[model samples]
Target: MSDVETPETAEKEELLTEAEKKALIALRRDEAAALRRWWQRLTLTPHELEKLTKQRSLPRGVRAVLRRCDSAEAAMLTQGFRELWAMLPESTKQTDYRDEQLQVWSCIALVAAELRKEESGVSLAKRLGQQKEQTGKPLMSELRFQQLLSCRTPEEFIQRLRRALALADKKGVSVVLLASVIALWWREHRGRLSAKPTQRLGFVLANDYFAATSGYSHRKD
Candidate 1:
């Protein structure tokens, strides 16, 4: 083997890196599409929706254990969650990101189960910003929205997210978008070190929230 690197070898290595990047992007797109499809199915099937919603009312202790992802208790307590997990892309079920996927999936199922409508197209943060209280303020206060983003655990996130989802349901926000954003948020949270500066999930959501709120406030004014 030669000690010195040749230009040809360096070019080959660069091309290989680019190929890997493209492959990763494609894989993520496929996974996201699969997740959206699963959420759409849940919305269309009333019986399945009913069963999943029941998981929300399970004892707090059981719900806490459900956050463990690998627990047999979670598997036994919610067949719906298991089915949802099974429907996810095989890459998501792999050991590498399995626990994070489950944590995100559980929260999505719980928050989405609270939705009264299954509409699509709008982002969750914008929908929340657009919704108004009877007193003519944004339904989700800035303080509350900040708190939601600041949650330190899955349990806290789910609890606040369910309340937010309920308000979103009143406005008929998109269930698919809602679930997908939460999934994206979880991925960003877990991989913050590797995430691009332009792609910060919190910044994206804050933009959506504040932009909508600004427009809404102006209209109200």
Candidate 2:
């Protein structure tokens, strides 16, 4: 009788083990088709969501740099690159590889290809950096560019890129919001000067706001 299993004990034994349950959870996460929880966890408040969603609010360059792609996967990867772009230590608006714009692009292109276990990090970095000029402005569809970064083996690179992009996008949004606040302050205070009515952003302070938001220096010096 001690060795014989009863109905309750049998039912308990049928339940999934911890490892099996974890595997099932992982499988579901991968099968979701949209990598929602992974990316969407970066939340925003209702007010911020309202602001960021407005079509006219985001600057043209910022919009282009952070625009969502049609393919869910491609959108994630391209955004990964853009975010990575802002974090790299760079001299603002410089025209050389030392600026890191092209270098990160080159890295994106190389890691998108086969992992080639034969490759070493040093060799890979050289190849990636050397051919960045070719990676600039790919004429292919956005999905193709995402496909380039979807290297299956040794997945650490894209993980890092995705993190960098998140940082960049956050900073980009902060800049836009801060500029808008400054613009609002100027619009209210300019009233004391008895200035004539004009375009919303044509005043000197407005121009400075634009320049600051662009991450560009408007000064002649």
TM-score of each: 0.65, 0.17
Q: Write the per-residue lDDT of candidate 1 for residues 5-112, one digit (tens) a residue.
A: 112333323322332233232125444444444444444454553443222122233323334434323433464465456655566778776666667776666565
Tens digit per residue, CA lDDT, model 2, 44-153: 33354344232112122322333333222343345443443332233422545343324333243222211211211111111222222333321222343244234332
Model 2 lowest lDDT segment of ten? 32-41
Candidate 1's error at 40, in angstroms?
3.8
Instruction: State the lDDT at 167 in candidate 2.
Output: 27
Q: Rate the local accuracy (lDDT) of all candidates.
A: 0.56, 0.28
Candidate 2: where is the Cα deviation over 4 Å?
Answer: 1-46, 49-90, 105-155, 160-221
